[model samples]
Target: MGVLSNLKPTESELEILQILWEKGDCTVRDVHEILGKNKDAGYTTTLKLMQIMHEKGLVTRDTSSKTHIYKALINQQKTEQQLVTKMIDNVFNGSAARLVMQALGNHTASKEEIDSIKKYLDELGNK
Candidate 1:
C-alpha cells in the first residue's frame, strides 16, 4: 500500500484516470475529446472532475504553460488491485476462488488468456 492505497476513486474519476493512464499526460481538451467518443460529457465537467482529482492526490496538474497538463499520480496496477481486493472482500466474502469461478463461468476466456492463467496458477502453486 502506498499513499493512494486508501484513496478510492469514484466512477467518474476512474474514467479520467483511465485516460491519463493510457495517454500518459494530457490536457483537459485531450481527455475531453477521447471521453466524448464514449459518452456525452461536458468539457467543464471533465475539467472540474480533474481539478477535484488533483486535490484528492489522484492526479497532478502542471500549470507552467497556457494549458495545464494532468498526469495520474496513482499507479494503475495498485488501483486495480485495491478495487479487486475490495470486491473480493465485500462481494465474494473474501473468497478469491469464488470470484475467479464466477468470472470464468460467466465470461469467455480466450485460449491465450487461459494459458496465461494456467501459467500464473502454476507459479502460485510453486510458491
Candidate 2:
C-alpha cells in the first residue's frame, strides 16, 4: 500500500491516475495528449496536477532523466475497493445487495456478465 492509500483523488487527479495505471510510467506530455482527446486541458495544467499527485503520494516521479516519468503508487484494485466500500456505506446505507440491485436495475447486463455474476454467487454460496 502507498502512504496515501486512503487518499481520495480529486476528479482531475483520478483522470491522470487512470492514464498512469493504464500506460504505466508516462511523461506529462503523454498524459496531456490523451486527456486532450476528451476535454480541452492544457499541458501545464496536467503537469501541475501530476506534481500535486506526487506531493500527495498518489504517484512517484522518476527524475533521473531530463524528462520526468510518473507512475501510480496506489494499486488500482485497492483504490476501487475503497471507493466502492465508501459508496456502499454512504450511498446505499451499507447494503451491498441494494447497491447491486440498483446497478443491475439501471444498467443492462450482457448474458455473459449475468452468467459471471451467477458463477460468482455460486462460489460465494459454496464457501
Candidate 3:
C-alpha cells in the first residue's frame, strides 16, 4: 500500500522523469534540450510525453506562468523499490536471495560496496 501502486512509467516516461528528478521542476524545452543531448528526440515528442505523464499523475506542473514547470509526483525511491520487487517476483520467482546473488555475480562490487552491503545486512539482521 504505497502512493505509486500499479503506476508503471513507460521507458520513455521514465527517461523524462529521471530528468525531472535530477533537475527538479523544469519546462518542456528544458527537458527536451537535456534529452536531445543524449539521443534523437524532438521537442514536441518530449512535450507530449510530459503532458501524458501529467495526466497519468506521474508529474504535476505549475501553470501560472507561460512556461510551465513540471515536477515528479511519485517518490523516486519508492518507485524504484516497487520496480525491483516486481522484477524479483516475475523474473526471479520471488526469490530475493537469487536476485541478490545474480546482481552480485553480474556486477563486480568494490570493497566499499561489499562492506556497505555487509553493514546493511547486519542492520537488517539486528532489526
Candidate 4:
C-alpha cells in the first residue's frame, strides 16, 4: 500500500485528475475545457470534482485567489508503479511475464518504444 492507498478516484474524478496532472496547476475552467472536449462536462462539474479531490488529498489546492488552482499531489510514476504492482499480483497471478505480454498485446508500439524496452532490459541484465 502507498500513501494514496484506499483512495482512488471514480472515472469522472479520474478525468479531472488527469487534467490536473497534465496541467500541473490549473483552474477549474481549464480542467473543464479539456474534459469538455470529449464529453459534456460543465464548468461547475469540474469545479466540484476538484474540491472533492482536494478533500481526498489527491490534489493540492492553492487558495491564493477567488479561483483556487489545483494540482496532483502524487507523482505519476509512483502511482503507476503501485497500480501495476497490484495488477501483476492479482490479475497476472504474480507473473511479470504474463502481465507484460498482456499489456504489449493491447497496443501497437513505436520503434522508439521497442528500443527503449530493449535498452531497459539490457540495463537490467547488467545489474
lDDT, model 2, position 95: 100
Which candidate leads the pack in TM-score? Answer: 1
Residues 1-127, candidate 3: write the lDDT tens digits.
Answer: 4766666789998899899889999999999999999999988889899999999999999999999999999988888898899889999999999999999999999999999999999999999
Best by lDDT: 1
Residue range 1-127, candidate 2, lDDT tens digits: 3433467798899898899999999999999999999999889899999999999889999999999999999888888787778789999999999999999999999999999999999999999
Q: Estimated TM-score per prediction?
A: 0.93, 0.90, 0.89, 0.89
lDDT of 4 by residue, 1-127 (tens): 8875677667787777677777788988888888888999678777788888888888898998998788888777787777778879989999999988887899998999989999998999999
- Those runs of model 4 whose alpha carbons end farther than 4 Å from true positions after fitting are none
| CA RMSD per model (angstroms) | 1.3, 1.9, 1.6, 1.5
**Comparison by lDDT, 3 against 4, better one:** 3
- State the lDDT of candidate 1 residue by residue for 1-127, as single tens digits: 5665567789999999999999899999999999999999999999999999999999999999999999999889988888898899999999999999999999999999999999999999999
| lDDT for position 21 in model 3 | 88
Q: List residue ranges in candidate 3 displaced over 4 A.
A: none
- Model 3 misses residue 104 by how many Å? 2.1
- Pitting candidate 1 against candidate 3, the one with the higher lDDT is 1
Off by over 4 Å in 1: none
**Stronger candidate by TM-score (3 vs 4):** 4
Which one wins by lDDT: 1 or 4? 1
> Quick one: ranking by TM-score, best first?
1, 2, 4, 3
